[model samples]
Target: MTTIRVQQHAFDPGAEINSFCARNPTSGGVATFIGQMRDFRGPTRAEGETVAAMTLEYYPGMAERQLDDLVKQARERWPLDDVLIVHRHGPLVPGDAIVLVAAATAHRSEAFAACEFLMDWLKTQAPFWKKEATSDGATWVEAQASDDARAAKWKK
Candidate 1:
């Protein structure tokens, strides 16, 4: 099964991973990645060294569709028993979990690779925009070429 959602509430990584692995007797390993809100800043926010809060914005339909596609691609490439992706939107503080990717497979290698692949693709391709509230003010962070480059490596 594949599950994807954009929620305002926080998620429990253990529960999410366990739900994905449940009823999958063939899965020998499960890998999970959780992304957190960090104190990231650009030139505009250099004056503010800390991220007080952040709000994630997304085109509801588009974001879900893009994530669904990535999950499907991962399933095709690996013998995955299950995959679950959940990304939270709305205001978040530093250290809050922003996203979660969990994958279950028969082998550890496949599980690990698929988890990494899902996270990389989501970082580059997902249509979510983030605005941070810093000491200076709120600003939208631009996407970097490095993120695209990281995702491109999965194609090879």
Candidate 2:
């Protein structure tokens, strides 16, 4: 089973994960990743404007098609019993959950790896464009080299 959703409202990651596990009761392990909004900029920068909010934008059908392809790639690489991806768009504040990914399989290794793979792809390859609001002003977030490096590691 594979489930995917893109919405503008807030979601409870704990509830979503629990439901995923319940629906795949026979799977031995389930790994999940929840991505949330943050207040800071880069990892090493000690001084700069902090992010107050963010807005994600995308074309509905295009985003869904990209997500489906990502799931299909994950399934081909791992023997997964189920997968779930929930991503939010629109205006969001710091500490809001932006995305959730879960992978269930017969072993911990596959579950963990697949979950990580999905997250990496989502971070770099997903179709959504984001704009961050800071004390200075709102700016469109650009793709970072570090994110591209992480996603590239999974490529054959």
Candidate 3:
């Protein structure tokens, strides 16, 4: 089974994981990754400008299609029993959940790898635009070189 959603509404990670476990009882392991909004940004992530809010934008149908395609790619590479992905757009403040990715498989290794692979792909390829607001001004977030490096490792 596969689930993909893109919306402005908030979601509960705990509940999502529990639901996934219940639905895939044959699986021995389930791995999940949750991304949250940060309050600050800097080298060491301790000092710097504080983000008041972040706005995410994406084309509705196209965004979901891209996410669904990534899930398909993950399934082709791993023996996954189930997969789930949820992403949010619009204004998000500090501590708000941004995205959730989960994978279930008969073994821990497959679950873990699929979950990580999906995240790495999403970070680099997901067609979403993000703008962060700070005391000074709001700026569009650009893709990081580190993200590209991480995603590249999955290539066969």
For candidate 2, write residues 1-156 as lDDT tens digits.
899999999999999988999999999999999999888776743775689999999878988888889999999999999999999999999899999999999999999999999999988878999899988899998888988999999999
The candidate scoring highest on TM-score is: 3
lDDT of 3 by residue, 4-65 (tens): 99989988989988998999999999999999998876655567778889999888898899
Better of 1 and 2 by TM-score: 2
Worst lDDT window (10 residues) for model 2? Answer: 40-49
lDDT of 2 at 51: 91
Candidate 3 to truth, TM: 0.96
Stretches of model 2 off by over 4 angstroms after superposition? none
Give model 3's clash tally: 0
Q: For model 1, how does the per-residue alpha-carbon lDDT over 1-156 read when each residue is reduced to its tens digit?
A: 888988999888778767677757678998999998887565454654677899999888999999999999998899988888999998898888899998888899999999999999999989999998877899898898988888999996
On lDDT, the stronger of 2 and 3 is: 2
Model 1, runs deviating above 4 Å: 40-48
lDDT of 1: 0.87
Candidate with better lDDT, 1 vs 3: 3
Candidate 2 accuracy as lDDT:
0.92
